[model samples]
Target: MKEILRSYKQTPASSIAARCIPITAKGVVRGRLRPITGDTLQNPAEIKLIAEWREASADWFTTRFPLSEAGTSRWLEQVWRADDRILFFVEDEECTPVGQVGILHYDPLKKQCEFDNLLRGRKGKFGNIMIYALITLGIWTIEELDVMEGFIRVVADNYRAIRMYESLGAEEIERTSLIRLEENGVTRWVPGQPGSSPPPERELATMRIKREVFLKLHQSNLPT
Candidate 1:
């Protein structure tokens, strides 16, 4: 899996292409998950949509900062160049871009990854879009990437997201204090740092899910 990811990172952005992951419900296709690549960023509308989604969902994340189109482009370009990261924009049955999901910190040896950037860019777009997108990514990790387990860290106060993960078979494995730090105008919550003290409200919940467990729970809904 690491070799595959390393190869992907080495590939030139212009040469990279999006992959289609079928999102199914009860053996029926509901939507699709498309990997974000340099080609995907070429479309102004698509890029703007992604930026907007990220900005709107900023509060739900551990990091919060002002977002700009250029900044978004730079951030995504870096992701495209990273060996251990991949993100996908979710689409509905109608093919409307609704949100994004990604996995990072991939450890090939342990076959483990951390779920990142799970957010619905558009409000009232698809009620269960995140769930479908998550399942799609999980399938890719287990079936395609050969990852055995996955983890996700969520802000302890973010109930909505926590509920969603729990519903999808994730279990809380640990709780870590978040040290809030502000540099320039951006504010972020880090697990810890030298000479840092965490506020009581700044807590993060780490959750884990096994590949076999996730697949077993959604096996019927998965496509053949």
Candidate 2:
């Protein structure tokens, strides 16, 4: 398992994007998860779609700023080359992207990783594509990457996301006050920084679930 993790970490982003991991539900392929590659940024339409989604879902994220296609292109370039992270696009069966998810903050020694950047851009014919996307990603981490646990941090007020995580067997494990940071006209909420005066009332909830627990809860919900 460690070797498998090492291999994935060493794989180039271009190759990763070409590899499609299917997201299935009820014995049907609902969507696919593919890593964002440099080629993805080359497509103007793709960049626009991602920027639009981020702008519309700004409030659901810690960082709130105006998103532009150029900015989105820069972010994609950075994330695709990251050593310990892979940002994925959730594409419907027809290969049209409907959302995005990511595996990041991996700790090989702990065999854990974080699920981040989960945002549903548009509804799919399956209706619950986002839920299946999350479940499928979780299963992949455990079965293929040997991740023992998966976790996510959500804005405390984001009740919809929290409920979805709970339904998939995650439980709130901790809460930390969020400190607002303003720089260059961009506002973001982050964990307390050193020398910070005081924590703000805004908070983020950390939710976690064991690999086996999550698998047991949803793996059987879909057919092999």
**Which candidate leads in lDDT?**
2
C-alpha lDDT of candidate 2 relative to the true structure = 0.82
**Model 1: per-residue lDDT, tens digit, 92-127?**
888777788889999888889999999887743457
Pairs with backbone N, CA or C atoms under 3 Å apart (clashes), candidate 1: none
Candidate 1 overall Cα lDDT vs. reference?
Answer: 0.80
Alpha-carbon runs more than 4 Å astray in model 1: 2-18, 123-126, 192-198
TM-score of each: 0.88, 0.87
Q: Per-residue lDDT for 95-194 in model 2, tens only?
A: 8899999888777779999999999999887899889888888887876778998999999999999999999999999998888888987988988845
Per-model RMSD to reference: 3.1, 3.2
